[model samples]
Target: MENSINVSSEVGTLKRLLIHSPDSGLGKVVPSKAQDWLFEDIVHLDTMRRHEYDYYVKTLLYFLDTEKIKGKLNEIDGDESRNFYKPDHPDYFNSEKVIELQKLLADILEDNLTKMKLIAAICAIEHEWYTTHDELLSLSPNELAKTLISGTTPGNEMLFPPIPNFIFTRDIGITINNHLLLNKPAKLARTREALLSQYIFYNHPMFAEIRKNLIEIPDNETLFLLPEEEAESNQSTLEGGDVMMVAKNHLLIGISERTSIYAAKQVIKVLFEKKVLDKITLIKIPKKRDYMHIDTVFTQVKRNMWVILGTLAKPHSESEDEVLIRSGLLKSKKSEKVHLVQFRRGQENEPRVIESLEELLTEISVYDLNCSPLEVQFIYSGNNEFPFGAREQWTDSCNLLAIKEGVVIGYDRNDKTLEAFKEAGFEAVKVADLLQDFEAGRRSPETIQNTFILLPSAELSRARGGSHCMSMPIFRENFE
Candidate 1:
């Protein structure tokens, strides 16, 4: 059956989301090879995976050492075919007895490769049967849960590189107004991320039917599948972080460091062709790591409010209206204008000009957003302080995740941004504080609006992402 997906606005109540809690994949990263695997720093995975394993082991012990097992052992002892079995017989050495033991272990072990090894050991000792890897994966969810969260290796070699960047799930794919656009990350570090989303949407039972009506877009790698001449200079790539829905039918995508114009053009073509979007506005920002995605600099906090990097909110051009009129290139009813400019990069040999949105208007306004109904007000990061804005932007001050209209989640460390929100009629609160109040029945989420729920960021901040970058909402309740 096809599952219905309705995500029309960023602040809609999230009903379903996909998250990969940290797993054994962390062990695949090492200091010497971190960069190769896309990790900037090494995490203590052995402890983390061991904790998961230990929990699984407890579940195994509880399930295996049951009254049924005792009864079965007694039955084996009572049976007297040609040879009699004894209660004291070596249970580990007996094939029938060991089969139950192996099943118990396999059911709770979380790492697939390690589970396979357990299967191999059982077969080798029993000399009874050999199980294939596919057969192991086909086990029940009770069995697969133990194995899917971690990675496994044989001896000293790393079989699967840990997906550290998986925490920032927003970069893997984008959920358009109604369709899902799976992104092809520009770097190899994130290819598996794309594959994971693809697998879930295609194979996972929850999304099986949705595939029928939902339009599927390509990863940048799809370009390589085309002829060389067709693929040349077509290094298109899009990350979910760069794509956003500012209104019911209006969208804004950034052609920034992480997203390329080539990729944007391809995505825009698909959106228009499918009629999935009415007005799509593409913005071009300076290609810098700190501002890798547009969300890093701009995102809707509510229907009429937005939080923006101070640099972008401030007019770089002489006049915001003039820039829009000169650079704005609006299409007919179905299309909008984007500006593109040509410039030189660091070296004369490098071309560094941005292609305009109507193809490069450097302003954020009603015309720029292409949504006149939106009377957007700004909440500047660092409260418009130069040094503070620069610092907080690096730490993702502008990237906030809206849970409901006027209520959002962000990093607690960005105090200035929080103050800016408060100044603009938003109430400030911490996640921990909110949880305590909710548990006490003191308040409900529905009653909260324009509230900023700040998350602790000791380690999360190190990932260089904010709350918006950490989640990929698959479904949201329709508000209209």
Candidate 2:
């Protein structure tokens, strides 16, 4: 709904965040349709919801209220309305249209009949039963989402496969330093993701002071693909999950499935014009099932070290692959061209020039390129299968969250990938409670509303994805 290209630095600290709670949608992901709905298996909606929510509550409790982290946020003002940046808040998150109508309905017919009639109309899309004689569903989404233990159908549409994954928070968008880049979701079903994000940028009182609130920023006619509103074309397309902030100036974009190069070019054009970026290197990875987005394969944990799910940085097959190499530190620390070195794999572990992070940075002239071992490294799910390639399929290594300096969060499945972080001087912590694993197909969520990751399945089979695919971080804690 709102496209504001606000990204500049990678070390910028995260001040406020928007999150959506897993809602009634979790109840709809039936085991029968889990495959088409993108789930491995159905989960016990209630228990799964609890596991997922606690993960966020625990993390936030450690940050938002803590004096150390609170003081670090650049913004000092704490306005409840600013919490538009927080989607879990019902005032900004629930369908405003529905709420508005409900209020009007209540004013006219403030009886049980009115309440029941109103709820039935709102949930006509889904058949919901009225437990209270009062008619109106009294439980907040968080309450229903948290208390739910098991269900055949997901009550909330946004929380299921196509939508439930939004809770991961790492997939939707990211912050390169202090700048925030809003992710453009690819599906209409997830279009509400943009709506949800807009609310977070608008209503959340705590996040009211954020600089990139799309709703409040001066609307730029130049940024809109269809400024006329009536213009139509099959060409307008973009998804936040396909983009990643590789460095302060570098972004690894995937042109596949949801987003295309045309959209990538448009976004790049906007960022370039805004002086938001100095360089843009598009890495067109294979558009296979395993390669959904950049998050599926690679992520930068420390300053120099990176965790790659696929062999994009390595060799793929018997043929020799060539990659473009650039210098990020050359000319100057603020060199216009980002240094990107392509690793060529010749058959098997063939020796290549500039091997290792040390050589990679030195050759690029990043003399002071410094990043201590990260506190933790997470993958999409808990899949520990290494260079086995399935790591690219099952475990999404691309979904990474740099919450603070050297502190990151991600799926807990990449057991060995965690080793990759430690090898780079990080203390990798594995966490697996963020997603709803299903029994049919393997899909991960890159978006997280507030702290909820939406997925269709209440169970784990092979259909649904984990946190990396459900979230997109518009801001982050400093990395370097």
Candidate 3:
């Protein structure tokens, strides 16, 4: 299958995306190493796979490649081995549309030279014994691919720490229109992920045609020469979660916990030079782990609508007295505020200062999308309730993936956020129920509109990401 790469807008009809399922590596996340691996808490691997991620795979397949999963649902579920969900197995539902990262890794490993180079690279970074390279080389492509990701050998011995965060594929790379911008992860735990992704995107046949368009952010030339404190501040680290290709001519880059200001500046300079887009918006959120990426605070539900955390969405009050108090409070706690700046191609010196996230999103709808002001809408996280708003936002209430315009998938545990969606005139349905309707021909993915599909997320939510973070959409029907 030819891999068509294009994603101009967040709410475009998703045609193809990259995803990684929960591997044995997740089960190996002991409490002591959980934080180091970037997981808030350890999760039950079986439950996360069978109950949580499996549903995501099925749903994506149903929407993007219906013939791959439409009638075989029961048969696929009945198998005790669950080979249907295993990328290495013969029965794996290998749909080109709903692409698997592990499967792509294995495909690249099939080449002898690529396998040797990758194994050597891994061993060098991991400080593995020289013999370890030969051992990994001896394994078959499928087994080697599994071991590389899970950090385990065929004998069930751990060779190294697993890349557990690989499940959040969106952090690896992002598709910007016809170009691919790869990530330089901020955390040491994600170094292996970046290396593995570099090899895949550069070496894989699927990305061969678009290799020239791969955008890699280079570090500052004098970064190593700076003082320790200055070097730390100047480090160029970026993740896909911080970048959003919101429209054909517009892009959003967030400076947060995982994406540095230096990196954002580099992106703006490189993209502007390449003429990838006309405008770039820099959203500076607090450098706190709770709001790791901009998508965690908000995401587009449709061309004219957005779901956001109320605290950052807008000012709390319009009354002069309350505004005065808020201004005083903000002066002392400036770090907590969200800052927005917009830069256009020719007018770089006169960048526009956006007041709030709501204002920026409204402008994207009204000006970029050409939607009427009256048609634009906002759904606050936790329905804008006090404690619920903060609590649900932490669980990624605002982080959602739109399968198509006005149709999204989020964690089922976010009840208040679901309520917010309902209040915004969207039908909230559980994934299991929706799958039945799709199977029975009662509803179709194409026919669905103004709906929110909920996924079972008891274990999945512990990983600290929503469907948006789990998906790396490479192809979407362009609104242009």
> Which candidate number has the best lDDT?
3
Every candidate's CA RMSD: 14.3, 13.9, 2.2
What candidate 2 gets wrong by more than 4 Å, as runs, is 1-15, 67-162, 170-181, 199-234, 315-387, 419-471, 477-480
Candidate 1 colliding pairs, count: 30
Candidate 2 structure, TM-score to reference? 0.56
Cα deviation of 76, candidate 3, in Å? 1.7
lDDT at 10, model 2 = 30
Candidate 3, residue 59: the lDDT equals: 93
* lDDT value, candidate 1, whole model: 0.57
Q: Name the runs in model 1 displaced over 4 angstroms.
A: 1-3, 43-150, 153-157, 218-233, 317-375
- The whole-model lDDT of each prediction reads 0.57, 0.41, 0.91
Tell me how many clashing residue pairs each candidate has: 30, 125, 0
Compare candidates 1 and 2 on lDDT and give the better one.
Answer: 1
TM-score of 3: 0.96
Question: Quick one: best TM-score, which candidate?
Answer: 3
Q: Which 10 residues in a row give candidate 1 its minimum summed lDDT?
A: 93-102
